[model samples]
Target chain A: MARIVVEVMPKPEILDPQGKAVAGALPRLGFTEFAAVRQGKRFELEVEGEANEEVLDQARKAASEVLSNPVIEDVVSVHWARES
Target chain B: MARIVVEVMPKPEILDPQGKAVAGALPRLGFTEFAAVRQGKRFELEVEGEANEEVLDQARKAASEVLSNPVIEDVVSVHWARES
Candidate 1:
């Protein structure tokens, strides 16, 4: 089986409320050197298919269409590798 | 700086539409031996603080409070390591 990984994150210009909440609490937690925080999601997929080139592209398309929010986020990438 | 990594995933019973879409496409991509697909998110934070015990806990709390969806997901874990 092949495993494909994808990461989804909010755009830099977009405001991530989740990130902001974490950033706001950093000072109380004792880390006082951060100016910002951003939150994102990662997906690992066990692709069931022959090790073909098209498999990776299919995975990417699936991610773009259904896995991530395009308007508020960008820079989604897919990494594919054989199971070890 | 301390780097903290966290992974968030939906509970096993929760249906991941993204995963289902990917699973549905496996045959078209050339593989026909898979039964399911699941997705998750990973976060890497450049925690700016002294390498202290509380720093790690802080990062975890930050993730739990803001980075993950507790209602739909569980098994959120945080990993802390110093920059080499």
Candidate 2:
């Protein structure tokens, strides 16, 4: 089976409270090098066959239409897991 | 500034209800090519400087210790955003 990986991130203009919370907590935990944190979603879709162009196209459609909310999140990347 | 990307996924043996819900929804939405779906987290950590080896190392540490719960989640990947 092939796996397609999809990544979604909050839009730059959007305020991500969960990300903010993590950023705040990081310093307290002594990870002071990070200036900011943005948390988002990742998805792995397993298919019966290879992750060919057709499968990738379907994965992209699913990513934008079902996985991510276009109002606040952007579908950052979508590709075969092996490519990553 | 440079950004480090960290990915976390539920352990294989763990039950991922959220992922299961998404998988179930896909066929109903006509995206039936997928056999399974796994949901995970993507984190972008912004740093003041370039994402060099040291920064990536620190990001890896933070990913494991602070970003994910070792009991149920696994830090799947940690790398420079540019590389992705």
Candidate 3:
């Protein structure tokens, strides 16, 4: 079965407290010369059955509905890679 | 400047409560036959200076620091996509 990966993250214009917190930890982590850091989500799902349009459609719907928060985030892109 | 995109996600064996919550909403959203969903992150950073070893090194450091949490997550890959 092919693995479908989804990435969910806040839009550039949005304020990400989680990312901000992580950014704050950079100095402590020994990182310098960096400005901003944004955070988001990555999902890996195994699509059972044939990778047909119906399955893909259902997967996309599920992603928008349950997998990601579209209100505060955008750029929900899905990629397919071989599982090997 | 190139956009370095990083995708962070919980390990496959790990339980993703957030993804579970989203997967639970699938049927209501018209999705069926979907079993589980795991979630993670995507960061698009405009890397300054020449995209050389130094820039890449610093960028990777920043990613591990402020952009992603390596504790509960892994697969922190950074892809350099031309910004066009």
Candidate 4:
């Protein structure tokens, strides 16, 4: 099967409260030396087809239109690979 | 600086309601042919250190202990790279 992965991250200018919470807790959890922390979304699309160009384009369109809000989020990468 | 990315996904046995919702909407949004979809978390840790083995281990530990819940979530990949 082909696995398509899409990464959706908040815009650099946007305030991520959840990420902030995690960043605030890291030091307490004994993890430090972080310049910053940003929490985002990881989407795994298990496709029943091959990882062809057309399929990848369709996945990208889906990610842009449905998976993320362009105003607040940025689609970092779309990876298409055969996983088993 | 090194960018350490930790991908936290719901266990395979777990039901991902949010991913299901998105999958259900994709077809309506004119994107289809997806066999399955699982939504997860993408954590971007902007570290002030180099991408050495020790630092990578520390990042992995932080991801397992603080960033994700081991009972319901699994760390799919831990990526450490330098990005300009």
What is the TM-score of chain A, computed separately for every candidate? 0.84, 0.93, 0.81, 0.92
- Candidates in order have lDDT scores of 0.68, 0.93, 0.68, 0.87
* DockQ for candidate 3, C-alpha atoms: 0.56
Please write out the lDDT profile of model 2 over residues B1-84, one tens digit for every residue: 789899999999999999999999999999989999999999999996665788788999999999999999999999888844
Model 2 chain B: weakest 10-residue lDDT segment is: B48-57
Q: If ranked by TM-score, best first, what sequence of candidates would result? A: 2, 4, 3, 1
Candidate 3 residue-wise lDDT at B79: 70
- Candidate fnat values, all: 0.39, 0.90, 0.59, 0.91
Q: Which has the higher TM-score value, candidate number 1 or candidate number 4?
A: 4
Cα miss at B71, model 1 (Å)? 12
**Could you tell me the interface RMSD of model 1?**
3.7
Candidate 3 pairs with clashing backbones: A40-B41, A41-B40, A41-B41, A42-B40, A42-B41
Off by over 4 Å in 4: A81-84, B82-84
Show model 2 residue runs off by greater than 4 Å: none
**Candidate 1 structure quality by residue, lDDT tens digits, A10-71:** 87788888778777776777556455666777776775657466767766776676667788
The most accurate candidate by lDDT is 2
TM-score of each: 0.60, 0.95, 0.80, 0.94
- For all the candidates, what are their Cα RMSDs to the real structure? 5.0, 1.7, 2.6, 1.4
